[model samples]
Target: MFKFTLKRFGYMLLTLFIASSITFMLIHAMPGDPLAVAARKLPEQIKANYYAKYGLNKPLLTQYGLFVKNAVKGDLGQSLASPGRDITETIMKHAPISARIGGQGLILGVTIGILLGIVAAFKRGKWPDYLVMFIAIVGISVPSFVVASLLQFFFTVKLTWLPTTGWGEFKHTILPTIALSLSPIATYARYMRANCLDVIGQDYIITAKAKGVSNVSLVFKHVIRNAILPAITLLGPQVAGIFTGSFVVESIFSIPGLGQYFVSAITDRDYTMIMGQSIFVSALFIVALFLVDIIYGLVDPRIRVSSGKR
Candidate 1:
């Protein structure tokens, strides 16, 4: 297990390096100068000095080397969009808001989705199954922003049950969380339903049924236990994505989170902010994937044993 973990950690580092390199190159390749906003009105000489100050005047390779070197030292540099603001510090400030919404959304979505899936599987060919599928289909078809709009219209505009937008209280969280959850709910439902049906038809399941195992045990100890693995696999990136923030949901609801910063960074061409956020998210994603691998092994010992041999 230790060897397996060490191997995965090494792979994570390699993946993060590649991702950061690609992001750095792409950000530099983007049309328009990173200094355009900051240097637009400055004299030519002053602009040149400004460029030098941010090291934007350097060659791409040298810039990349400096970025990597600074990043390794935990200095992601200042925001070109908002001068004097450290990119790392900026992310740290707003990450909690995104995390809170995302964590709630994921929990609500996955739990309900798995339940709907199990119901759909067990009640196959019945109205209950059809109803669950219909809901899942709607969730799948509608985008989160649109859902956010509808939720706002009904809950805030019409019923006055919730605020239209803002980020102070718990009420502000509900609409965004629900909007974000819809897609995952649909995804987990479809995958879990399929997995459950496949598990149900397996030879072990048949034998257990023949031996008069209770339906409850058949569903819980056998069916759900096996069927949930796919959902667990899907969970890792979703966890990472929370930190990246929900760009649309945050915008629609006026929540001040990391997503808001990212969107503005792109719009303003803040190179450091963009690259820092991207690298941070990539690292988070890699870490989450690593944890998923560990959890995957724990959930199914066979995977660990097979991987150990490899």
Candidate 2:
């Protein structure tokens, strides 16, 4: 287990390095003078001074070196978009909001998806199964931004049940969370339903049922416990996707989260802020995957054998 963990960590570092490198190269490759793109608020003399101060006049290698050096020291440099706040500070401020929103969405998504799947599987060919599948198909078809906008229009504007934008209160979180959760819930439901069907049909399940085990206990113990493992196995990637992909939902809802900042940084050509966010996101995604791999080993015995060989 320890050896496997070490190997996974190594892979994580490699993944982060690749992601960071891509972020660096892509930002540098964009057409335009970064400082000019950042906007020339100062006079020519002041601009020259700014260039001299920040070494903006230097070659791309020198700038990349400086950026990497500061990054290694946990200094994300200044945010051109936000003059007073540093890039790291801005990201830190925004991360928790995204995290909270994503966390709630993940829980809601997983729970609803799993329940709907279970019901569908239990009923097999009944109307309940068909209805749930139809809903899942609709969810999978709709884009998140469209869903978010429609939700805001109907739930917020027409009904006034929830806020259209901002993260001011509990109600404000509802629309965004639902929007973020919709696709994942639909996907997970399909996966869970399939797994549940297989487990129920297994010989072990028949034995348990023949022995007169209680229905609730049998579902929980023999059926779901075994069946849901596959669904649980996919959870790590799904969670990572949730937090990272919430950018669209956050933007649509006007939520002040890291996703919003990340998008803004790219659009504004705020290299430092963009790089910092990229690094943070890469690191977070790797860590989530690492933790998930470890959990997979703990829960699924087959993974242990494969991991050992690797």
Candidate 3:
């Protein structure tokens, strides 16, 4: 187990480094100048001094090396647009904003999705099954932005029951949460339902039924337990995905989240903010994939044993 964990951790580190490097190169490759962005906000003399002070005149390779070094030492440099604040601090402030919405939305959406899927699969061809599948289709079809707008229109504008934007109260999160979580929920449901139906046909299930287990208990103990294993495998990857997808949801709903900062960082050409956000996002994914690897053991011991075998 320890060996497996170490290997996964190593892989995650490598992946994160590659991702950050790509982001840095892509941002550097864009036409125009990072210094020019500062020049527009600062006087020519001030801009020249700023560029020299920060070594902006250095080669791109040098800048990339310095970036990796500074990042390792927890120095994200200074913000060009939003001066006088540490980029790390600026990003941390927005973490909770995004985390709040994504976390709750994940919980609510996953719960509903798994339940609907299991029910639909177990009762295949029935009215309830068809209805659940239909809703999953609708959830799959509608894009998050469109769903967000429609939700705002109906719940906030027409009914005036929920806030259209912001992160002050629970009401404010209603529309954004629903919009962000819909696709994943639908995705999980379809996958879970298909997997569950397959599990029901396995030899073990046939033996359990032949042994005269009650239907209710069979559904819970045997069926659900086996069916949910695959979903557990997906949890870690999905958590990282949730954070990334929240970028759009946050923009539409005007919620003050990390996603908002990410967009603003790009538009404002705040290199510090961009780097900080990029690193943090990369870290989230690395940690999530690591956790997912460990979770594989908890979900099914055979995975743990197989990893040990190598």
* Residue-by-residue lDDT tens digits, candidate 3, 49-97: 8887676878989989998999899888777776677777776677888
Pick the lDDT winner.
Answer: 1
**Candidate 2 — which residues are off by over 4 angstroms?**
37-48
What's model 1's lDDT at 64? 91
Ten-residue segment with the worst summed lDDT in candidate 2?
32-41
lDDT of 1 by residue, 145-196 (tens): 8999999999999999999999899999999999988877898899889999
Output the lDDT of residue 92, model 3. Answer: 69
Between candidates 2 and 3, which one is better according to TM-score? 3
Please give, for residues 1-310, the per-residue lDDT of candidate 2 as tens digits: 7887788889888888788878888987888876784437788888887776666788978887888788888887887666667888877788888888788888898899999999999999999999889979988999988998999899978999887887778888888888888887898889889999999999989999899999999988788878888887677677677668789898888888888777777788777788888888778877888888887777777886787875
Q: Pick the candidate with the highest TM-score.
A: 1
Instruction: Kindly report which residue stretches of model 1 are placed more than 4 angstroms away from their true locations once superposed.
Output: 243-245
Point out where model 3 deviates above 4 Å.
Answer: 40-45
Q: State candidate 1's TM-score.
A: 0.95
What is the Cα root-mean-square deviation between model 3 and the actual structure?
A: 2.1
In order of appearance, the predictions have TM-scores of 0.95, 0.89, 0.92
True-vs-predicted CA distance for residue 250, candidate 3, Å: 2.0
CA displacement after TM-score superposition, residue 20 of candidate 3 (Å):
1.8
Weakest 10 consecutive residues of candidate 3 by summed lDDT: 30-39
Candidate 3: the clashing residue pairs are: none
